[model samples]
Target: MTRTRFAPSPNGPLHLGHAYAAIVAHDLARARGGTFALRIEDIDGERSRPEYVAEFFADLAWLGLQWDGDPVFQSARLGSYVHPGERLKAMGLLYPCRCTRAEIAAAATLFGPDGPIYPGTCKHKQVDPEGAAWRLDVAAAVALSGPLEWVDEIAGSQRAMPEVFGDVVLLRKDLPASYHLAATLDDAADGVTLVTRGLDLFASSHVHRLLQALLDLPVPTWHHHALLVEPDGRKLAKRRGSPSLGDRRRGGEDGPALAAALRDGRLPAGISLSRSLHTGA
Candidate 1:
């Protein structure tokens, strides 16, 4: 059976862009007579809030999205990440890095999709594992996995290039697992067959694909839909003060009607859809 998931971080209220992604994942599962799942990605210890998590459920329900089974919270699954991380460490594919963000920025001359890529400053350094962030040796990992490719429902097939992002952090200094490690493990655990989200995350699939190969987990197809942007062409984001779904609900807007409007391309004033496929690094 085909299974899809809408994993959202409970760091803020859900906005229209989030609603669009949720609705797409939910409808895709329903249309295929498959299962739809929701996962709360609340691993950010500093920013995740209980109030935001409560609002996440309320917003999804208000938007007429009923997920199968209870939501899986990433916070409770920290232990599950250790085994995979250790396996990589045993294989000499993971290394402890002590570089701070400022240090990396000072050393890096080139930037990838996610800001300045790490210059592999600690790739060969012998750092204490405790309280240190772990980075995957992208070149070594790709060599082990060989040439790999994944398919996207919208953009078609893509060759996996994990090196584009440099050595990505698999485990954070402050958290047990990074987003790349946790999300990849959770998707496999939940049996998600179709990973649905916005196109801005399209490049992330390459890293996730490599993790799947390294961990010997089941691979899933991806569907990176276009992002919903403001009139200024910036993507809607909670940090940018984008209006939340709760704000709309409190203002008496019908949730189901708004979902239908989004599906039909009748976006609200000052909001438009950017359908371009972002495959660039």
Candidate 2:
């Protein structure tokens, strides 16, 4: 049986963008006669809130999306994230990073399409400061994985070479698993054959693909859908209130109304594509 998860970080309210992604995942599972699972990515204790977490479920259900199994919350699955981090560490693919935001900004030189890349300042140094971040040693990760490739439904065939993103961060200094670490592990563990997420996460796919290779896990097909944009084409986010699902809900908007608006391209005014994408890219 095919399995896919709609993992959302419950740091804020589910907006129109969230609804689009959920609908897409739920629709695909229905089409394939598979399972759609929900996972709460609440590892970031600083930002995650109990209220928001509760609201996330209400919002998805409001949008008429359903899951096959009980929703899994990452905050409760700390142990699950540890094994992968240790596995990569055991293989000597991970290293301690001590660069501060200021330090990284100061050192980064070559501005690539993805913005200023890591400059390898802490790559050679054993600078694991008291609260310093950690990065995967790209060279070691590549050696462990050999080479890699994966298929993306919308982005089509995708490939990554280690030279692109050197030693990425798997765990933060605060001991919480980073997004890449938790997502890759959970997808593989749940037997997710395909992943449907936003386009903004396109670059992060490289990091996740690398983790799959190192962990020897099955690589799921990815579909980086287009993001729901505001009238000015700005990405919808909690920081912007008008497009927020929470705001709309409080303003007397029901689930059916919201979902209909999204499906018919009526919600948020300028959102048109009936089958458009929901990626952050």
| Candidate 1 backbone collisions, by pair | none
**Number of the top TM-score candidate:** 1
How much RMSD separates candidate 2 from the native structure? 2.8
Give candidate 1 regions above 4 Å deviation: none
Candidate 2 CA-lDDT value: 0.75
RMSD of each: 1.1, 2.8
Q: What is the TM-score of each predicted model, taking all chains together?
A: 0.98, 0.89
lDDT (CA) for every model shown? 0.92, 0.75
Question: What lDDT tens digits, residue by residue, belong to model 2 across residues 1-281?
Answer: 66777888877788778888888788788889999999888878689887887788777876777788888888778888777777777777777888776777688876543556779887788674567777888877777677777778866776665455555677888765787788888888888888988776766777788888778788888877777776666667777774666667678777877787766667555754322433222
For model 1, the local distance difference test gives: 0.92
